[model samples]
Target: MNFNFLDKLSPEYRNYKIERIKNGASKKLFFKISKGSDSFVCTDFNSDKLEYKNHLVVHRILSNIDISIPTLIEKNDDKLIIVSEDFGNLRYDKILKQQSIKDLLQYATDTLCIINKEINFNPTYTLPQYNIELFKNEIAELPQYYFSYNNIIDRIDSLNDEFFDIWIESFKQLNFNFKHFVHKDFNMNNLIFLPSREGHLKCGVIDYQNSFWGESSWDLFSLLEDSRIFFTDQYNAYFMNYFYSHSNQLISLKEFKLKYHLLNCSRQTRLLGRWVKLANELNQPWYLDFISTTKLRLQSSLAILQNNKLTKFYDKYIL
Candidate 1:
C-alpha cells in the first residue's frame, strides 16, 4: 500500500498513481500503475522471495511451452515486488456472462488440456511435487477452522483420515501419481481471452505462482467447481466428457470419472475451511458467499463417490 518503495527503483515511477486490483482473496497486494496511459501490474508478495523465484521459473516454462501468460517486466528482489504485463480487466468469467457459457468454457477447457499434454515436469528444473502431507494439511484446515471448537476435533480428524484413505485407495486403484504439472489456481477468473492470438495462445494466464506437480485431476476440479462461475449441468457434463475424451487416456474412462469426483470433494472440502477462515480470521464475508454452492458441490461429489458416512459428517456441520 506504500509507493515510497518505488522511489529507489526508478524516478519515472515515483510520480505514478497507484490503484489496487481487488481480484482475489487479498492475501497479496496487486496494483495497477498508470503513468500517462502506459500501465503495468505490480504484485507485492507477503510471502518470501523464493516464491518470486518460483514464479519466474514457472512463468518461463509456461511461456516456452507456448502457453499464453503475462510477460514479466521487472523484479525488485529486496522488496519482493514483481512487475508483469497487465492483461487488462478482462476475465473468462465476464466473457461467459455475455453469451452462452458452454461455448466460452470449451475454449479454456481445450486450451488447458493442450497445456497438460505438452508440459511435462522437468526433472532438471526441480519444480516441487505437491505431496501427501501438504495435501492432507490443505484438507485438514476444514475442521481446524470450522468444527474444531465444538469438541468434535476427533470426529473431524477421523473423517479427515477417511478422506486421505479414500484418495490413497483411488491412487492405487488407478495406478496414477501426482506427476502432472498443474496450475494450482487454474480457473475462469485467472484466464483472459486474447482474440488477437490464435489457438491455445488465445488464453492468457495469470496468478500461477502456486503451480506445482500435482494430481492430474486437481486443476480440472478447480475449473469445473469454480465458485465464482455458474457451470450449468449441461455445461459441466459437456466439459467433463470433453476432458475425458481428449485426455491422454492414461487412466480408464470409468476410473478417470471417479478421480474427477474425488478431486471435487477434496477441493470443496478445502474451500469450506477457507471460507470459515476468511470470515472468522479476516472478517471477509465475500468468501462465505460460496458456502451454499460449495455444500451442493460436496453433496454431488459425495453422491458420486457413494460415501454416505462422510457425507453425513459434512452435512452435520455445513448443511
Candidate 2:
C-alpha cells in the first residue's frame, strides 16, 4: 500500500501530497495536489498501456457529454492523473448503508437515466454486435483461471455437453442491437453521492477507464447486481421499470430479461476467471472471496437457460 510514486514527482508537482484511499477493489492512491483553485486526483495505473489509454478516452468522452466525473489533470510517461470536482468521501454504497431503501433505489434510477441520456447508441462500440465467432475467440483466449478453479473444472465436466453447447449457441442468438457508451464498472463503489440543490442525491461517476461501446444494460447490471451490495427485489423492479419507461426505444420486457440474465452470466464467468488468475498468477488472494458468489450466479443463469420454456431451442441446436 506504500505509494512511493508520489515522492518521485517533480518539484512543481511535489506540493501535491499523497493520500491513501482504501475504498476500492483496485489499489488506489489519491494524490491531493495544490493547484491555485482546485485539487486534482492522481490515481496510479498499473494496467497495460492499452487499458491506460482507454481510461483517458472514456474520461474525455464522458466529460464532453456533461457527465459529472473528475477532470483529466495530466498523463506523464508513467502516471495518469485528473483534476476533478471534489465530492468529499460519500460513495453511493456508503450512503446506501445508512440511507433508506427508497432513497437508494431513487438514486439508482436517476443515475441510470442520466447515463442513458448522455451516451449515444453506437453499434461499433457495443458488445452484442460482437459476432459469435469473435465472442468465442475472445473468450477462448481467456486463461485457464476461468475453467480450472476449485472444483470449477469438475463442474464444467459434469455439466451436460448438450447444455454447454446450447449455452454457446444461445449466446449467438441474443439480440445485440442497442448500443451505447457504457461505464464498464458502474457499480456503487465508483459513484460519489453529493447533495443536490433540492437536498436529494446527486451522483458523480468515477472509475470509467473501462468504458466502451457496449450494451445499455451493462452499467445497470453492474450497479444492481453488484457483489458487494445487495439490492432488494422491490427496488430492483422499480429501477428496471423506471429505466424502461424513460428509454425512448427500449427492448421488449422478454428480451430485456433475457439480456439481463445472459449478460450477468457472462460477466460473472469473466469475473471468476479474473479472480482465479489474480490469485494464482498475480498472487492476489483477496479476489478468491468473490469466486463463490460468481459460481452461484453462473449456476442461476444455467438453470434459467434450462427451463422448459427454452427446452426446444436447446435440443435442436445445443443437443
Candidate 3:
C-alpha cells in the first residue's frame, strides 16, 4: 500500500507524509501527501482493469474548458499513481447542511447545465461511450444482490432473466444525443464546494474522470437522485425546473423525467450490487451502511416507472 512514488518522482514531496483517504468504492487507493503547508491528493490505481489514464485526460480537457477540476501536478505512468491539487475534505453535502439543500441543488444544477452548454459533443476528448449494452450489463448485476441474495428471487437464472428484461425495455426509451460530457459519478460526495471561486468554478469537481458519452440528463439524475442523501420534494422540483429552463428546453421535461426515473433505477440497482461486492469481496463492511437508502431510492424509481416486468420482479422480492 506504500505509494511513495510521488515523493520519489518529485523532490518537493520527498518530505511528504502519506495518509490514506477511505471514502471511495473503487479498488484504487487514495493518499494525502502533506509536506508542511503544501498538500496534494495521490491516487494509486493498482488494478490494470481501471483506466486511470482516462481521468488524467479528462482533467486536461475540463481544465482548458474552465471547469474547476483538480490540477494534475504529477503522475508516474509505470506506478499507476497520480498526484493532483487537493480540494481538501470539503464536500457538497457538508455545504448543503450548513447552507440550504434547495439552494445548493440550484447551484449544482447550474453546474450541470454548464457542462451541457460549454463542453462540446464529440470534442475529441476520446473517452469511452456509455452505450445501451454497457448500461444493460451494469444493471444485470443487480439481481444477485437486490433479489437473489436477499431471497427475493428463487433462482439465479430467473433473476438474470428479469434483470435483463426490465432494463432492455427501459433502455429503449432513451433517444439520447450521445454527444455530451456525461459525468457518470456526479453526486454530493464527489463534488467539492469552493466559496472563493466564481461561477461554476465555485464547485470543484472530483471523481468526474469517470465521464462518458451520453445525454447530459444522465448526470442531472445522478445529482438529484443521489442515494447518499434523501433529497426533499422541494429540492427535486427546483433541480428539475432549473435544469430544464437553464438548458433552454434541451430535452422535454416529460422525456427527461422518463429518462431520469429509469436511469436512477439502473444506477441504484447497480450500486446495490456494488455495495455488496465491496463488503463481501473487498472486506469493506462500511459499504453496507448505504444499502438501505440506495434500495429505497431504487424502489421509488421502480414504483413510478410502472414497468410491469420490473413491477412484478419487485413485488416478488422487495415487497
Candidate 4:
C-alpha cells in the first residue's frame, strides 16, 4: 500500500532516497534513507496526538537511562524520525526460534536484569493508569465486538459480570508494593539481539510506548510465557531460580509464583479485549488467531488462583 504521507515530506527530507521497509499499525510507515551518511528511520504519524506524544515520551525516558534506544533525529507535526546504531537484521524472535533454550534464557535474564537496574520510575506517566478497573471495563465491553461469534461470544459474555467483579476485588486484595518501570510489551519481537564485544549476545529494547510503572512480574511473565515462543517448564524453573539467586533483593519462590499467575491473567484479559475489538470493530481478522492462546493462559492463571489460599475467594465467586 502506498503511504500517503510519504509524498507530503518536507523538501529537505524528500531529497533522500527512501526505501519502504514495512507497514505498521495506526497508519505508521517505516523507511530507510540513503541520503545521510548514517542510515536513519522515519516514522510517519497519523495525527494521533496521544500516540505521538507517547512515542516521544518513551524515546526521551528510555534514552535518559542510557538504554540504547534509537535517538530522535527530528519531528514534524506528523512524523518523528530517529537515528541510532542498527542491529542489522537480528531480532530476538528469530534468535529464540533458532537457538537453544538455555542460551535464550540466559540472554533474556541478563538483559532484563540490566533494564531493572537502569529504569527510573516516573509517577507522572499516564500509562500506569491501566489498573484492574481499566482491565475489567475493557473486558466487560469486549462482548459487543465478539457478539457475532455466537458460541465464543456467548461464553465470554456469560462470564463478563462475574469476571470484572472478581478481578476488581482481587486487585484490591493483592499487595501492590512491587513497583518498577515495566515495558508493557516486553516480548521477543520488540527486542533486538546484537553481538557483544565479548562475543556473546546483548539485547536492545524497542517499541516501548506502552511502558509504565507496574509489577515487575508482568515483564518477567511476558518474557517467559511469550505467546509466539514457548519455554520448557524445566528451563523456566532454572531461570526463575537464577534470577532469585542473583538479585540483591530476593523475591520468594511462592511470591513469584503468585504474582506470575496474577500478572499473566491480567495481561491475557487485556489482550482478549484488544483482539476482540480489533477483529470485530476494526475489521482486522488476524487478531482472532490469538484467542486460543489467550484462553489457555487465562485458564492456567485461574487454576493457579484457585489453588492459592489468598485468592481461593475467586473460586467461590469468579470460577
Candidate 5:
C-alpha cells in the first residue's frame, strides 16, 4: 500500500498521503499519493495484471508523438506499482457539464486529428488488430450478459446467430479501413483538461493501454457518442462535419457517417451488456444507471445505420 519507491526520490515522500481513486471500471488500483501540496498517481496491479506494461509502452508512443500525457516518475515492478504525475481532478467528463460543446470538442477533435495522422500501423509496441473476430467477441457481451440478466436466455443461441449475421454482413459491406490508431476508450472520462497547454495539447489523454490499430471513426464515435453522455443529433452532426472537414481524410462524409454509426452501435451494445456484468459480477450497480443512456445511443446508432434486419432483431429481443 506504501510507495516505497518514492522514498528514494525524496525523503519528504516518505510521509506522503495515499488515497484510492474509485473511478475506472477496471481491476487495476489507482491511488493518489500526496506530499504536501504536490501529488502523484500510484498504479498498483498484481503481476498477472500486465496492463501497466501496456500503459508504459503507450506512454512512450504518445509522448514521442507529442500527445499530452502524465509524466512517468517511476516503475517498481517488484512492488507492482507505477508512479506518474497527477493531472488532478479536471477530467473532461466532469467538465462537459460546465463548458460549451463547441469549445470542448474543438480540443478533442484536434487531438484526434493528430492521432489519426501521426500513429503508424506498426509502432514500437505491438498491438492486437481490431479484426472481425474481435468485433464479434466484443458484441457477444450483449447476449451473454444483457440477455441473461433480462431473463431472455431461452433462445439465446438463435438470437446470437441472427445478431452476428446482421452485424457481420453489415461489417463486410462497410469494408472499413482498420489501419488507424484507436485509443479504444477515447472518451471524455479518459481526457484531462490542461488549461496551460496550447491547442490540442490542452486535451490530455490517459488510460489508453487498450489502444489498438482500428478504424479512425471508431475513436471518433467513442468521443462523440460516448455511452455516459448524450449529445443531440444536431450537435453530433456539426462536430462530425468539423472533424471530417478539418482532418481532411480521403473518405466521403456518407461513408464516414456509416462507419461512425456502425461502430457506435457495436460499442453501445457491448456496454449495454457490460453494465449487467458490472452490476452482477463486479458489484457495481452504479453502472446500471447508464443503461438507459447506453440503450438510447445504441438505438440511435442502429437507426442511423438503417439496417432493417439489425433494427428488427433489437426490437424483437435486445432493445
Candidate 6:
C-alpha cells in the first residue's frame, strides 16, 4: 500500500493520481498511472516472490516469439514494480459480451496454437513440469481450503488421501508426458483483446508467470472449459476442433480429448477449493461467486471421464 518508491521512477510521479485495477485472485497489485491522456500500467509485487522474477523472464521469452503481450516500459527492482503498456479494459471476459463467440474464440484459439507451437525450454532456465506430484499438490487446495472451511467432511485426512489416489490413477491412465508450454491460467480473464492488431496477435496474454511444461491439452482445456465461463457444448466442440485442425500437435483428437478432460478435472477441483481459500484467507469474497459454476464444470468433466472411483469420491463428499 505504500507507494513512496514511485518517486524513484520519476520525481513528477511523487504526487500523481492513479486508479487501482481489479487484478482478480492474484496477490499482486495493478494500477493505471495516467499523465494527461497517456497512461501506463504498474505491476506491484513482493520483491522476494519467485513469480515476480518469472514474470520478467517469461515476458522476454513470449515477446521474442511474437506472442502478443504488453510491452515492458520500465522496471524498478528495488520496489518490485514493473511498468508496461496499458491495454485498457478490453479483457476477453469483458469483450466476450459484446463480440461474437466465433470471432473471439477464433482469436483466442489461434493464440493458443501459436503459444504451443513456438515456446520451448532452454538449458539456462528450467520451468517446472506439470507432473503427478504437482497435480496432487494443486488438488490438495480443495481439501485444505474448501472442505475445512465448509466443515463438509469429517476425518478429512483419510478421505483426502483416497481422493488423491483416485486422481493419481486417473492421471496414469492418460499417460501424459510433459511436452508443451502451459500458461497454467489460460482462461478468458487473463487474455486482452487488442483490436488494432490482426490474427493471433490480437489476443494479448498476461499473468503467465506460472507457465510450465505440460501436456498439450492442458492450456486448451483451461481456455475452452474454463470454470468461470460457460460455453455451450456446441461452442466448445467447434472451437476445440478448430484448435486441433490448426495447432498441428502430434496428438490425435481422441487422445487430446481424454487428456483435456482429465487435466481440466484437476483444474476445476483446484478452483473449487481455491476460491473458498481466497474468500476466507484473503477476505476476497467475490471469488465465492464462481464456486457453483466451478462445481458444475467439475461434474461435467467427471461425467465425461466415467471414472467410478472419482465419481464416487465426488458423490460422497463434494456433491
Question: What's the lDDT for candidate 4?
Answer: 0.62
Candidate 2: 10-residue stretch with minimal lDDT: 310-319
| Model 1 stretches astray by more than 4 angstroms | 23-26, 148-174, 315-318
Best by lDDT: 5
Each model's TM-score?
A: 0.87, 0.76, 0.89, 0.78, 0.92, 0.92
Ranking by TM-score: 5, 6, 3, 1, 4, 2
For model 6, residues 54-80, the per-residue Cα lDDT tens digits are 888778778878668888988877778
**Which portions of model 6 show Cα errors greater than 4 Å?**
1-5, 11-16, 149-151, 231-233
Error of 5 at 249 (Å): 2.3
Candidate 1 shows a clash count of 0
Better of 3 and 5 by lDDT: 5
Least accurate stretch of 10 residues (summed lDDT) in model 3?
A: 1-10
Better of 1 and 2 by lDDT: 1
Ranking the candidates on lDDT from highest down gives: 5, 6, 3, 1, 4, 2
Worst 10 residues of 1 by lDDT: 167-176
Pairs that collide in candidate 2 are 73-82, 125-213, 126-213
Model 5 earns a TM-score of 0.92
**lDDT of candidates 1 onward, in order:** 0.73, 0.61, 0.75, 0.62, 0.81, 0.80
The better-scoring model by lDDT among 5 and 6 is 5
TM-score of 1: 0.87
Clashing pairs in 1: none
What lDDT score is found at residue 290 in candidate 2? 68
Cα lDDT tens digits for candidate 3, 27-144:
7778888887898998876674256888777777777665678888988888787888999877887766686666566667777887777777665777888788888778766665
Question: Could you list the CA RMSD of all candidates, in the order they appear?
Answer: 2.8, 5.0, 2.5, 4.2, 2.2, 2.1
Q: Per-residue lDDT for 279-315 in model 4, tens only?
A: 7666778877777766666666677667454245333
Model 3 quality (TM-score): 0.89
